[model samples]
Target chain A: MNESPVIELSGVCTRFGSQTIHCDLDLQVAAGQIVGLLGGSGSGKTTLLREMLGLLRPSAGRVRLFGVDLDDPDLLIQRTVRRRLGMLFQHGALFSALSVFDNIAFPLRELRCLDEDWIRRLVHLKLAMVELETAHGKLMPAELSGGMVKRVALARALALEPELLLLDEPTAGLDPDRSQNFVELVGSLQQALGLTVLMVTHDLNTLAGLATHVAVLAEQRIIAFGPKDQVMTVDHPFVTGFFGADRRKLL
Target chain B: MNAIPCLRVEPGRVVLTGSWTLATMLPHLADLQNRLAVPLPAGEHWDLSGLTRLDSAAAVLLWRTWGNAWPEALEIGELHRQVLGRAADLPREMPAAVKHAFHPLESVGRLLLKAAHNLRGVIALFGQVLLDLAYLFRHPADFPRKEFAANVYKAGAQALPVSALVGFLIGVTISYLSALQLKSFGADLFIVNILGIAIIRELGPVLVAVLVAGRSGSAMTAQIGVMRVTEEIDALSTMGISRSIRVVLPKILGLTAAMPLLVLWISAVALLGGMLAAMLQLDLSLNYFIENLPRAVPVANLFIGLGKGLCFGLVIAVVACHFGLRVKPNTESLSANTTSAVVTAITMVILVDAVFAIFTRQIGVPQL
Candidate 1:
């Protein structure tokens, strides 16, 4: 890991009207690590991920990704920094009108510098990476099943070879068998690409083998952050119930 | 990285090794599957000891070739065992394959059933909105005033530029043609009579109705349809909020208020266009055109036009919300409902216009 963190948040505050989601929260993710963010329902795991992705700004703190401040005044700097980050939303969020091929090719096409042949090759390569058949490329998003949608979404996120990947509940809807497959896929993808990933998930099985570090959010801030096993030993009530007392049931 | 992924089968065993990942870019998987499926001996063993690295993609390819299971005679260490074990459990993702052969008659029957079901859904939604309206009449606090005002601005005020442009162009064409024909008949002065009645009574209402149908009608349908897709409508219902009051009623009230105003605005702009064309083609003065306009097209024609506008607005809003709530939780359904809302609203407008023409025939037309 590098000395400078891939992602850094300091003294972050997020509030909606009278409800405060996070107050003076702080987090850091080293390079090439997969960090699973776990929290109970309404614990603001998704909100923190959004803040890190620059989708939502903290009320009173700094959010930095790849050493670039997300709230920078310069639009060009924001765009440049954002281009290096990729996000996979809870639902696929694929363009409905476009075919799977076109959806994966969207970022490349937006760049306008790649040749058609190169774009086609890269898209095919990505589809293969996610274990999708070449014929499936022509299909629309509605025709895909829940598992396929997640795979396609992962492929799209990897299109630009982003250094940091943000995932919103990567395995909320999949069956146990499929969720295991998803976890393996995410694990291998992180290793292969050397991606620094921040994932918000409730699936404990996903955190078992996939996450190098685990961050537990409770009372609007991270109560525990460390190696998955170490964090599991934390004395907090939510942490204990989440990792030790109810591990078998949750997993 | 130097180790190329390769599969070599000998009499006793199959050997696999190399950097097999998405980045490594292996050859076509199907070709590899074919080579491995050539009836290997029953006791042939597999070796992965030489493999430097393995990822899910590569493991999946190997698993698929092995008939979606780990080989019984596989010779692998604990590290490889754990890696391959994860991939072995994946349920084969069955693509949405059309199972039965295509039958034209059966397909046509299915489509008809779907249409009938959709019609029933729209009617039910309409009835719900009507019931909600009755309830609102008794208790008004449940109404969402902010949302109503916002929708009015969206569906009415913002639509001004495009509606004005379309109305003006249509008016220019209609008046220019009528002026030329009237001139040939040596009755050039009758151009005002023709333009006045048509712009105020028929053209203005119909044009505004069609424009709103395409513009605001589609927008309303799309907004509600997206809410349906994302389960926002469900959340509202779960929270003890009536969707009809919070979502549907405001749109109906807003468009109802805006449509008459839009009709009047379109009529004014259209009349201006007609006056311009008359001045150019028939050499009619502005003063004469303005002064003769009230006598040529009585105030009754304006009222009739506004009446049609109000009715058309009600139908469009109701129809848009009806189809919107009918949308399934899919992108295909959202686009489909939006298109259907626009088409249905326009058809209803034309049908209503025909009825309006017959009933108000004597009221708006000036006697010769």
Candidate 2:
């Protein structure tokens, strides 16, 4: 593993209207590690993800991505840092007005460096990467089925060839078969592109299939963080209850 | 790790190095494009093994630069070759956008069909509300009384201040302008007849109709449209509730019930404004204006005004509900339906008012 961390959260705190979600939370994700963030409902899993994306600022401490502070004042540096990571929202928040092709091409077009031909080719490559047909590009987001919506959203997130991928419930709505296919797709893509992934998921199948490292969050902090099997062996209530009888099957 | 992407031309070879990713290439894109455009020797060797990372964007650029073919002599890693292979495998032709040839006659026919279809939908919705009313009459327990009251509060009670403000301004403007004309002709008393008849019979209903159409009508469409988009309407139907009884009828009936009251309120306030302006400009006494108003404008005109208010209210509500129910499940459809609801309600109110004008002209007019 690389020594330098791709994401570092040190002593982070999040409070909402007299309710504290996270206090003094610290996590360091090294390069190319698929960290499955496990937590019970309302345990601030999505909140932590949003904090990392800079969509929400922690009340205290620092959030650093690629070794640069998210609070860095320089606009150009912030933009550069943002372009290095992509996030997939829980509901596949695709733009309703744009076609699937335009949605995927949106980030590339923002660069203003790639020409139309290159964008067209890159968009096709991304669609293929997500196992979608080229014809799917012509459909609107509203027209897509639930599975297709997830795929299209994934394609759009991967548009800029982001080094870090953040997925919030990537397979929440998919059936077991489709979710398995999605897991395999993501696993192969992660290996090919050497992407560091941070995913929040409740599905054990997804966790077992893809995550190289596991981080269990409880009591407003990460209770355990290490290689999957090592983290599973940690004597924490959340870890035991979460894995339950399926611990050996995961191995 | 953060070396700038460079393409160096050496003897008998082209060497590409560094992290050739989008972020690294963005600033030097123009320079790279310029250098890549220059012709190289036919049999030159290309070296890309030194590159630490290569994103698909860089792969596409390289694929395009090499004349859509591999270099004669090239040294590249297996992973880089796979990235390049994906780009090269992209289909040459893009999917074509759908096109239609313009035909004026067919276009006109389609528009007429659409209008007829909309008219049928409005009539059907009106019939459904009537049916729902009949059903509620037998089972008064099932009536959406709270929804009706809420709609009235939102559309009717909340609209009072704005209506009064607009009504007062129009009354002042018309009364002041007429005072100027009446003073020159020594017909100052005639100002009472003009203001009373114009405001009570025509302006009150039409003004309130337009305001209500823009305010309450658009809101009704948007509320129902969003419900449709989020499947709330479907959820309601799945529970065995008639949407027309619970959703559509309350809005139409509430607006219908509130509109006549709104017209009466606005007309009374507007007369007060006209009275104030008359006092300032014509030195007309309030007692004289009030006492003689019954004789000058006649009581039938007040009845005509209230009747027009009732009809205008029904038409506006029906038109608004009609367009609201027509909304499809998309943002574009929601916005389009809301706009069409407001516009169609106002237009229908004006059209109904014109018909009322022609029919009631003889009843409301005083004999000279």
lDDT of 2 at A183: 93
- Find the 10 residues in a row with the least total lDDT in model 1 chain B: B21-30
- Candidate 2's residue-wise lDDT over B104-216, tens digit each? 99999998998899899999998999898899999999999999999889888999999999999999999999999999999999999999999999999999999999999
Q: Each candidate's fnat, in order?
A: 0.09, 0.60
Against the true structure, whose lDDT is highest? 2
Model 1 spans > 4 angstroms off: A1-251, B1-3, B8-14, B27-45, B63-74, B82-96, B100-126, B136-153, B238-241, B359-363
Mind giving the per-residue lDDT tens digits that candidate 1 earns over B148-236?
Answer: 99989998999899989998998899989998889899998888888888988989989999999999999999999999888899999
Error of 2 at B343 (Å): 1.8
Query: How big is the positional error of residue B100 in model 2, measured in Å on the Cα after superposition?
Result: 5.3
Top candidate when judged by TM-score against the true structure: 2
